[model samples]
Target chain A: MLVVNTEFVPGFEVTKVLGLVQGNTIRAKHVGRDIAAGLKNLVGGELKGYTELLTEARRQAIERMISQAEQLGADAVVNVRFTTSAVTAGAAELYAYGTAVTLAGGA
Target chain B: MDGDAATFNFLILLVPIVLIVLGAGVGGLTARTHLRSLERREAELTSIEVNNLKFVRDPGSAADTRMVLGQVVIATDYFKSLATALRNLVGGEMRAAEGLMNRARREALVRMLEDARSMNADEVWNVRFGFSNISQMRGKQGAMQVEVFAWGTAVRRGASA
Candidate 1:
């Protein structure tokens, strides 16, 4: 249930490394938001709409990764990393990956 | 009727040019303001401790570590984006785009520092960063949006050293 981006958790010994666990999600652009972003691009401040869209995508990807780690009976997930790609013109794909491991002590 | 049509055609041609000029002016002002704010924030964060070391070399320090993450996404305006489009064509360095990216990374780093400060963390270690593109569309020409993310482990000293 715990997640850290470091390879080793402080004060906890990794007894078993389950394997790599990952999750990914692809989201397409919304027509309304796309129009809003286009207008924002003209004057260009932060496009709050697009920012929120990517934030939501990242959160969902992390949630899915956590579920997979839980299924593996892992005490913690470590060395987590996120990557993103523009697979198509109007779609974005986000991937979250990490190593699942069990600590010597129960969480 | 001829005069009316003539004015209509002239108006149609004038509007897009006007919009681009106005967009440049507004976007310039916004960028200036953001730069001032970022400079002020960076000054404020000067007191916070930061490190990119692999681990705490001084052992027996007994520090509690927790992961901290910060992310910021920024969009380009009409003027700089035009410059970027040109850079793409000629295959040369894009200084304008570089400035925009620098701003995004600084914003993300400041947010991470704020998170560490909230937890009374004296120093951060194992810092990392990521950059990604998002909010793409088919019809839009020369539109670029990027997100910068920062991550580190914040450590609070437990007085065990």
Candidate 2:
């Protein structure tokens, strides 16, 4: 599927609007990663483990959104957006949402 | 026993002072180095244009288009955290925390641009940023860190255009 974060995809027109599709996931940092992040904080630098954790969560959220779009027979997902919230001290929720639409040309 | 107690008291006093000094020296160096690198990379990647506009005018026959993402998590050193803590008492701006956030944002943006460059895209559109504070514990302000995520649609122009 063609996914773009813009309202309209270039070279294609939307023929059918399938409304909004969304996916979300909440993940908590494990003890090992948390400990690593704590030490890294002392010297103040990028937390690679946390970055990977978020990347994985975001990818899963987007994948879930895409699957939902596929269920709606969408040719593309447009105007996609992501948001994050700290559900708890060590856990975060990642949400991906977008409009699913059928384009004039198939992906 | 008295001497041991006295020595213990002195050690307690010395630890914080040592930590603050180490934080200042190392953390300051890290931030400076990172800023320099950001400047150099930004100059190198000036060829690719990026914007937040939802739509592109005359996209020049787009060959390919897709979403790109960049993410980063950054934390403040002990010195900044202490500085912020003290600033909280005075109710003033936390310049140290501000610098940390700025660096994280720029790093995320630069990474997004690099992702676009890898795709051989000429322009990025509809850029958006997402952020969240992670690592704080319940009922306590633990290590302070911020996560910045930058995303956009990368467009590569067709040969015809």
> Least accurate stretch of 10 residues (summed lDDT) in model 1 chain B?
B54-63
Tell how far residue B80 is off in model 2, in angstroms. Answer: 0.4
Off by over 4 Å in 2: B137-139
Candidate 1 C-alpha lDDT tens digits along A2-87 = 67677777666789999999989998878898788788777777777767877788878888999999999998888888888878
Give one digit per residue, the lDDT tens place, for model 2 in B1-161: 99999999999999989888887888899999999999999998899899999996574488889899999999888888888888889997889989999999999999999999998998999999998878553114845788999999999887876
Top lDDT: which candidate number?
2
Expressed as tens digits, the lDDT of each residue in B1-161 for candidate 1 is: 99999999999999868777866899788888989998998898787677776564342353666677777878888777877888898898898788878888888888888888888777777788889776453434576777888878776776655
Candidate 2, lDDT over the whole model: 0.88
Which lDDT tens digits does candidate 2 get at residues A1-107?
98899999888879999999999999988889888877777778888988998899999999999999999999999999998877877678899999999988522
Candidate 2 residue pairs in backbone clash: none
Judged by DockQ cut-offs, the docking class of candidate 1 is acceptable
On DockQ, the candidate that comes out on top is 2
Per-candidate TM equals 0.87, 0.95
TM-score of chain B of 2: 0.93
Native contacts recovered, each model = 0.47, 0.68
